[model samples]
Each structure stands twice: as C-alpha cells, then as structure tokens.
Target: MSLRIGQLPDRTPVKLSVSVEPDLACALADYAAIYAETYGAQEKPETLVPVMLEMFLSSDAGFKRARKALHARASKGDT
Candidate 1:
C-alpha cells in the first residue's frame, strides 16, 4: 500500500546516535556533500538531513538494482 500524507500516524521526534566505522562515516559524508552540492543552493545542514532521509527511504528500486549489480561483480570475480 502506498503511504498517504494524511494517513501518517502522529509521531514525536527523539534524539538517537550511533557510531560508524571511519570509512563508512566518510562515505555518508561524501553522499551528503554531493547532495548538498547538487540540490542545495546555500548548502544548509538542516535541509540536507531531511532530504537525505527522504532519498534513502524512497530508494528501494535503486537499492535493489545496486545489490544485483554488486552480486554480479562479486560472482564474476570469484570465477
């Protein structure tokens, strides 16, 4: 089922933090930076986070395609 804006449940914001490996952190930063560069005019952090979340959550098709490509590359290397 598709989500409707009016059908969303009420929610409260909570603060959460997690640690990532240095390389992974760098990757995330790089992704955010590129997003800011392309879409961000002034490159505000406030705008960047929400947009990043939206992109991540909405990217099921992209993620599936990426996973398939990665598996193909790995299998090719194993042969």
Candidate 2:
C-alpha cells in the first residue's frame, strides 16, 4: 500500500503539536517502528507523523490536482 511512499526530503525541522486517542498514538508508534526497521534507522513517532502525512498527501491524485488548481487561482488573484 505504501510502495510509493518514498524517503522524506531533508529539510530544516519544525515543531508541531497534536492530540490523538491512545489507540491512534499506539498505531503511530507501531508505524514508526516499522519505518525504522524498513529504513535501518530508528525515528520517533513525532518525526514519522509529518513524513507520513506528507506521503499521504502527495499520493492523493485528486488532492494534488485540486491543490494545483488552487495555486493557479491564487496566482491569478482569484479565490
């Protein structure tokens, strides 16, 4: 399912805060563990969250098209 989830870009880190249920937290932790094992580098769940989110967003074709349309409108001073 995540075959297209490529490596995250190397960039300056930013901090963020979010709240999730215990089960979701555990699931993120599990994903972090698998990500570490898969890539041979351990990462905290905090780090995985953004990378996973970016991967999810980038993989959505409809979202990408809509985002491009929004950008085009914004560039043209349209909302």
Candidate 3:
C-alpha cells in the first residue's frame, strides 16, 4: 500500500487528536526516527499511525469477516 504498510494511496485529509502517556510518546518518537531511517524520509511517526492501524486491521481476519457481514447486511437493507 505504502512504502511500508497501507501507505495511503491518496492524501485524503483528516484531523484527529489523541492522548498518550509520556513513555508512549517517547516510543513514538523513536519509531518516527526509525521509520525515517528506513524510508529515507524524515516524517513524524504520528503521521504513520493511522496507516499502520489500517494495515493492521486489514490483516485481521475477524475484522474482515465482521466488516464483510456488516456490508452485506447494509446492502440487503438489514442493519
């Protein structure tokens, strides 16, 4: 999808704010540095979080099944 996981084929914009503890914040900073080193581009780790999550969720079979079922029901006018 992206250079790593689900790298967003498009740059559709969404703004969100999240709260995390100091340790997690430090970890994310570390991750950002690593990601920059790996990808040869310096970008905030937070920028990758949503794509990472989407990729992770995409890889989850249970989520896929549930989403598929929900879609099917929606198409059939059954909530």
Candidate 4:
C-alpha cells in the first residue's frame, strides 16, 4: 500500500493587530538586529517578523505544539 500526504491550501491575507510589552518588543527588535548583522543583511527588523512567524508556523511539530498550548491556555481563560 502506498501512503500519500496532503498539502495545505493557500490562505487568504488577513490583517492582525497585536500589542506587546515595550520591553519584549525592544528585545525582539534587538534579536532581529543581531540576526541581520550576523548575516550582513540590510533588511529592517520589522520585515523579519513575518518570515520568522511563517517559519515557525510551517514546522509540523512546532505548529501542533503551539496550537495545543494555545488552546489549553484559552480553555483556562488565560488569554
């Protein structure tokens, strides 16, 4: 018997707004800057956020674990 794996369909573009603590935001920016500097790239940190998010979301285990944790937290009314 042969096994087949299905691919995810393309998603529509959506706009999301999120607010982060000032320190967290600064830390993320600093990390991004370091990454860019290490790679000798000129892209701004803001441009890296979506790419990082997509990379994380694209990993099967990472996505599943994140979703499970998020659901569990939501069920606990932690959000």
Task: Give the candidate order by descending lDDT.
Answer: 2, 3, 4, 1
Over 1-79, each residue of candidate 2 has an lDDT whose tens digit, in order, gives 5777898898877777889999999999999889888999999998778878999999999999999999999999998
**Clashes within 3 Å, all models in order:** 0, 0, 1, 0
By TM-score, who's the top model here? 2
Look at candidate 3 and tell me the lDDT of residue 41: 93
Candidate 1 global CA lDDT score = 0.70
Candidate 3 all-Cα RMSD: 7.8
Task: Please list the C-alpha lDDT of all candidates, in the order they appear.
Answer: 0.70, 0.90, 0.88, 0.81
* lDDT for residue 71 in candidate 4, whole number 0-100: 99
lDDT of 3: 0.88
**Candidate 2: which stretches are off by over 4 Å?**
1-12
Summarize candidate 1's per-residue lDDT along 35-74 as a digit string, tens digits: 6688775554444556677688678887778878999989
Ranking by TM-score: 2, 3, 4, 1
Considering lDDT, which of the candidate structures 3 and 4 is the better prediction for this target? 3
Off by over 4 Å in 4: 1-13, 60-79
lDDT of 3 by residue, 1-79 (tens): 3465655587777888899899988988999899888989998878878887899998999999999999999999998
Model 1 C-alpha RMSD vs. true structure (Å) is 10.4
By TM-score, the better pick of 1 and 4 is: 4
Give lDDT: candidate 1, residue 32. 66
